[model samples]
Target: MTDITSTELKQRQSAGNAPTIIDVRETWENEEGRIEGSQNIPLGTLPDKLDELEALKDQEIVVHCKGGGRSASAKAFLVQHGFKNVRNLLGGFQGYQQA
Candidate 1:
């Protein structure tokens, strides 16, 4: 999967056709602020939420964290777990804010 830039995400969001977004940051970090409709699923809990996330396996999903690292890991995990379309938000939330 390719990485998506914040500018592209904002464009998709404004068009009301954004892909499903996953926030892989800690609960506290996520509470600080986040993409409007991104679902918060802390990285550590992803395995536990596999069942809950099963339905999205074939959907285009984007993952992000405070920066890019955690979300990169999340994207790799999802891909390994059979998710068909997963991408990391380039530069993550900070980048999104900057954009």
Candidate 2:
């Protein structure tokens, strides 16, 4: 799936149709700021959280990090693990903040 821009994310959030958003940053980084309602799953921990996330396999999941790098890896990891609809958040939280 194509990455979602911060602007596009904000629009969906405002409309109350936002997808399941996962913040793939360190816990402290996520505590600094995060899109409301986004869950923190930190990139490195995604593998450990697979069972917990199993129910969401076919659901649309949006992943973000401090910038965009980690989230890209997270998206790829989830896809490799049988996730059918995972997307990266373009520019990540920094871009979302700027937007």
Candidate 3:
């Protein structure tokens, strides 16, 4: 799996090559604040939501949580499910905010 820093993500976004962002934080956490255009699918629901993301299998998918841990797990899960390009957003939402 690849590790993407928030700054790199922002740069890619500005370049019009942004990857699909999947937020793994819970509802409440997401309600507070999140990166624009990110999809909220909490880690717990990822298994069930995998089908919804089938179209992204061959695309670059970047996963994030409040912190890095959960997103790492989420990335692993996607890789196991045959996602060709999955990445963990290093430092997650907090890092994005800082960026």
Candidate 4:
């Protein structure tokens, strides 16, 4: 899986080349704040939601969570499931905030 820095992601968004951002954090965690336009799909529910994401397999997907761990797992899972353009948000949401 590829890794995308928060700064790089921010630049891409500003340039209007936004990838689909998937937040793998829990619902409560997402209630705090999230990158604009990101979709919430907790890591635990991802497997059951695979069909919902099938159409996006060929598109760029950026995954993140409260920290980096969960997103990393999500990225790996997507890749294993044949997602061709999946990326992990380096440092996750906290890092995005700092960036």
TM-score winner? 1
lDDT of every predicted structure (CA atoms):
0.95, 0.94, 0.93, 0.95
Writing each residue's lDDT as its tens digit, candidate 2 over 46-98 gives: 89999999999999999999899999999999999999999999999999999
Candidate ordering by TM-score (highest first): 1, 2, 4, 3
Clashing pairs in 3: none
Which model is ahead, 2 or 3, in terms of TM-score?
2
Work out the TM-score per prediction: 0.98, 0.98, 0.96, 0.97
- lDDT per residue, candidate 4, 1-99, as tens digits? 569999999999999999999999999999999899999999999999999999999999999998799999999999999999999999899999999
Q: Judged by lDDT against the true structure, how good is candidate 4?
A: 0.95
Poorest lDDT segment (10 consecutive residues) of candidate 3:
1-10
Residue-by-residue lDDT tens digits, candidate 1, 8-46: 999999999999999999999989998999999999999
CA deviation > 4 Å runs, candidate 4? none
Worst 10 residues of 1 by lDDT: 66-75
lDDT of 3 by residue, 1-99 (tens): 569999999999899889999999998999999888898999999999988999999999999998899999999999999998999999889989999
Query: How much is the lDDT of residue 15 in candidate 2?
Result: 98
- Cα RMSD of predicted structure 2: 0.6
